[model samples]
Target: MGRKWHGQFEGEVVTDHAEYPLRGRLPGCRIKHRMKRNWLKMYDKAGWILRVETVINDPEEFRVRRRVRRRGRRRTEWVPLRKSVAYLFRYRDVSLQSNAQYLNALAQVEDPTAGLRGLDTITTRKRSTKALNPVARPDCQLFTALMSGEYAVHGFANRDLRSKLAATVVRLNDDPRRQSAQVSRLLHRLHVYGLVAKIPRSRRWRVTAFGQRIMSTSVKLRQWQFPANWPSCMTPSKLVRKNRRPNEGRSYAPFSGGPSTSPLRLVTPAIACATNSKLL
Candidate 1:
């Protein structure tokens, strides 16, 4: 019964048996217009139970007898009628721990290589080959785009990523090529590898959290960089604009309220330390 109502989430009708189609397993029954009121009262009293059967008065279309008589004859016509029927519902309370196992299984299915550890030194997955590897130039680009936070809400489309790549990353020849087709194929490959998922009923793709984490780690490794201790070097309020070049003697005050220096060059700790030493 719980599975039968699951289709309601997907815009399917409750009466339709698409999700749990009726077959030879259960005996066929027609919807009845009348039900015992005593049974409904009993079910209502025990409504606090997890699983219970209740009688509901639902409207249905059917033929009904009409009082409009001609030549001493009664007539029957098709009309809508509110009828009572029996319905059984089963409920279960699901918690985060209960759903965690399913989520883990789904993640493994999405990206087979995501949970793997120590591919270079300690451990390696058996029955895996280089040919089955998914990380490539295009895949890297897609991952980077997903991590950029530009498409955080609506995801991204093929044309959107293609244009972005053409401007900054992928170089196109003077003659031009089938960029549209190439981008489509690239997106399909990413979907197959479970890096990006296509939104249902839409031509957009969103990166999974696992994909984002792996891409971020890969970028850090490639640049030989590590995560910073501080949140950011400067805030918006601290930003300053220089109208003139450094040689022109344009200066800005430091955040430490020390002597001003040229805004064009970066202020390193060593420079600040030397300045303080001289002042001392």
Candidate 2:
């Protein structure tokens, strides 16, 4: 629920994976969104009660504006969610409102894309539309560049990505304005695809949770099994041992279950038969 917020968010509030440990990793909300010090935490109690609580570690986070005198000049000052019995009602109201918003948004979600179906939108190319096609050599390069580890923190700006994108897709015009414009278009496409989102009140973008997963997988697809590098392919388990240019034609053989009740099975033996020889 906390992850639904379009602001600076990190981990999912309602994930089985625990980012924050409280007496070991518990399956519940332990997100530290609003601020590092102040956050809203909700978890199950006794496997029944839904304990939703907000903690304002730093009172200054919730500011109260007031006029204060400073050197005979009246200047406005701010004061700061939960830490006093006197304002318990205020805290409860705020917490309940946030809970309502989270639940409301979650309720309205109709058939959210939680499957791999969305991958088609990124890798499929249509000449008539300006959609991204990561399957292409150039587009795949551009797609991987956006997932650079450095930009994970504080997001990235046009200047930060422009040079990277230009380096990969050198076909783009040499003009800086053109490069910047191209990068802008790429970012727009990423935003449209939900792979990235613009930081509020800033000209920067951060990869969302979904973006991290989908982009990483998409990038790996560029190197998926093709020319004898199947070990590191996306489906690593599907190994191939076929007779190729150098290997003898007898690549696989059926194991004989002579006199035994065990069922015979076909297996690829490491040792290949010599040319023009037949196994007995």
Candidate 3:
């Protein structure tokens, strides 16, 4: 009997023998051998003729072929499956908590907001009942200029404010002399919005605490883009009671009366007559 050889290819076992393929015959081809020890015959499912035949050769020297169907026609071709370099170097999968811990540790290596300051106190105007949030476009621009310290000092004129914001924003016209009208409109809107106040009869304006909050927070948001993962050092300032002192410019007195011990009373407005109206 010829020497029998056994080996594996891509986890599949194969067998071969010596002197398997005769001259002018392919490897693994079935043929009547002189020793008759290297022939294998497999009958077809219909059992009419032999379909699969193998001749013993080198087990590791086998070729693989696949049947591919295209346009309703079938064809046989050789296709080899092999491992890639990236697959050999890939790392094992990690757990969710492990990944999160790694990211948390990586974040602690540096602080992005170490020197940044928190937002200032935000309060609505004393006599104004409108919500102070969502500042308007012109108001936001004017407030940013006012809070930049230079314009905030000694209060700034419409021209000086325009000069400060000229290169940064495009709201002002190209002609410096013609910017007064636009600047005055923005100042009037800011006053109406209650974000800043004018000193009795002066051309200058001062930003309120509410305006500081709105402008600074808006600028910070625009600059930082409100990243998905907020840094650890971006903590806000600690809050204190504005009414702690009795002489502070508090709008209303704190409710010292205990929780209501009786049912609440409701007030209703009386309808007015059209004939008694002052502006009909």
Top model by lDDT, which number?
2
Error of 2 at 5 (Å): 48
Per candidate, the number of residue pairs that clash is: 0, 3, 3
Better of 1 and 2 by lDDT: 2
Colliding residue pairs in candidate 3: 16-57, 17-56, 17-57
Once fitted onto the true fold, the runs of candidate 3 whose alpha carbons sit more than 4 angstroms away are 1-142, 225-280
lDDT, candidate 2, 1-280, per-residue tens: 2223456656344323233334664444333334455566556543455655566555544534557788999998744533677666655556666677755755788764654567776555545446766557776686687789899898899998876766675366678898788788878877777789999999999988878877777677766643336445544222333325444333334355454555544333334444214542
Error of 1 at 90 (Å): 47
Residue range 51-104, candidate 1, lDDT tens digits: 123233332312223345558887765344334222111111111222344344
Question: Predictions ranked by TM-score, top down?
Answer: 2, 1, 3
| Range of the 10 consecutive residues with the lowest summed lDDT in candidate 3 | 87-96
lDDT pick, better of 1 and 3: 3
lDDT of 1 at 141: 59
Worst 10 residues of 2 by lDDT: 234-243
The number of residue pairs in model 3 that clash at the backbone is: 3
* CA lDDT, candidate 3, residue 192: 66
Please list the residue runs of candidate 1 whose C-alpha ends up more than 4 Å from where it truly belongs after superposition.
1-114, 117-139, 168-177, 226-280
